[model samples]
Target: MLMKATVSGSDVKTGGIALHNLQKRYGNAIAVDDVSLSISPGEFISLLGPSGSGKTTSLMMIAGFETPDSGQILLDGKDITRLPPHRRELGVIFQNYALFPHMTVAENVAYPLRMRRMAKVEVEKRVGHILDQVHLGALASRYPHQMSGGQQQRVAIARALVFDPPVLLLDEPLGALDKKLREHLRNEIKTLHKEVGKTMIYVTHDQDEALSMSDRVAVMHEGRIRQVSAPKDIYRRPADLFVAGFVGEVNLVPVKLKSGTVHGPASENLPAPEWQEADRDATLCVRPEHLHLKTSPPGSSGGLQGRISGMTFVGDATIFQFRSETGLELLSKVLNVLPETMPGVGDPCVASWAANDATILTE
Candidate 1:
């Protein structure tokens, strides 16, 4: 069991990190471009995106690890863009544990405290307290080699928190762990954040991790943030095509807006409700999970026909890849337990998705 709640004040009582017109360019190649965001104190914000999308670069700027070509980084309304990383007073846990192999877990966790020239008794007390907090008290005397990857990561986290820094920065901290272990640690990390109540900036390319752990996620793309919102909002209503495609599996269908109604690729095949007048050139974004696979009632409105191209069972649901009669590729997700027989490959299937499930986007 973990330690019960303690009424220690906010870890980063200094209002949190802010970036204004942040830009980083490496010889004409823009790494992070004109990004402005403010992370609130005690909030866990994740920079999420695919590789080379500027998520890590932005996090590095926040951590004072990377120099921005232009812009201001403010911590608690005070500029810290030119400050050295150590003077920023933030805790950081890197991808590679970065623990000395020769050092015991206790020693590793105590190093930060020792650097501050803290008293021996105080260091021991704090180290012991944090070891217990990370559930590594039993292995305190063991070296990194003697511990599992997960255990070593716990030690790294304990070390980061040992100094009680105002903010925490995690850069792909769970990337080295296996899927199940990673998922387990994800929850543990969130719980730790709540327990510590420290402002955290997490960087990762994994959408699931970002969606599950963040208070708010900023989706980066091509060196700029595409969208920043809560997980459900980001998934359900993405701001643009990039976000819709990046956040999850989505099918993009070419749509033409005529008379305020969106027509499918097979124009006028499906009757859709009239859309707003401003929806011209809109593309429909539909998630596989929202598509319903069923037999078509004769001439049912807003229904389309497709043939099952492939089906894959994925634990809780079956994914159906359908090739529409209109030559469009689509997918549907059906719950595993339902008796509604899944259409086999090459079988004719009627696929229908709610008009509301599809998001209309231009460009």
Candidate 2:
């Protein structure tokens, strides 16, 4: 039982961290561009992208591990760009569980407090309290080697959070765990985030993890932030073609806006899009779930006539791969409802979507 309901009225309030025009370069390659971002107090933000996207670089710059070629880092209105990692009031958990193998869980968690010259009584109290919080009170005496991956992860979290630092930076903390353990601990992290209300910055390459866990997600690509918004917004209204294709399963078909109408994979013309000055070099962006699959194409209407080339059962939903007369392939997702309503392979289907449900993305 995770004791989340009983946790409230934190002794230490969270502090926000800000990155102003942060830039990083490694020789000739630019690692991070001029990116300015702000994190709210007690807000949980995730920096999400593929490898070498500058998510880790931004986190390291804030953690004082990497010096920004330019720009400043501020902690609750105070400049901390030059502050040493040890001197900054920050808690960090790395991808690998960095626990002392020789030390017991209690000792490991108590190390930070001890280094800060906290009283022995206070350290013991804090260690005990935090161990119970992470449901590790029973394993307090266990060594890192004796614990499972999940257990060791909890120990690392307790150690980082025991001192109740204002800002917590987690760099791929769940990357080492298996899918099941990653999911289980991810929920615990969310519950813990809610229980403690601390400002957290998580770095991950997992889209589902970031979308499900973060209050706001910053999507990075090639050392630049493509977009930062709520998970739903980022998924639905991506800032560009990269974000639309990256975050979730999307069907992108070449679309042309001619005169007052838009034409794409669907058989008919669509209403003009409300966007910037006369830019038709665009693609239609639609999620699989938004596609409405029917037995036949709606004639004279803007619907796609296709064949169900493939069908996949994904527990909660069934995914269908479709191909149109133009040889354009697309995907549509339908929930696992009654068996009678499910479409199967070789079935003729028409995929149509609402005009507002799709977004027009340039480049």
Cα-based lDDT for every prediction: 0.84, 0.85
Q: Write the per-residue lDDT of candidate 1 for residues 176-213, one digit (tens) a residue.
A: 88999999999999999999898989999999999999
Q: Model 1: which residue pairs collide?
A: 260-275
Off by over 4 Å in 2: 1-14, 265-267, 271-279, 297-302
lDDT (10s digit) by residue, model 2, range 220-339: 988888888889898998889889889999998787776546676443664335654353657888899988788864343347777899988899998889987678899998887678
lDDT of 2: 0.85
Error of 2 at 122 (Å): 0.9
Poorest stretch of ten by lDDT in candidate 2: 1-10
Off by over 4 Å in 1: 1-15, 269-274, 297-301, 337-340
Which prediction has the highest lDDT against the true structure?
2
> How good is model 1 by TM-score?
0.92
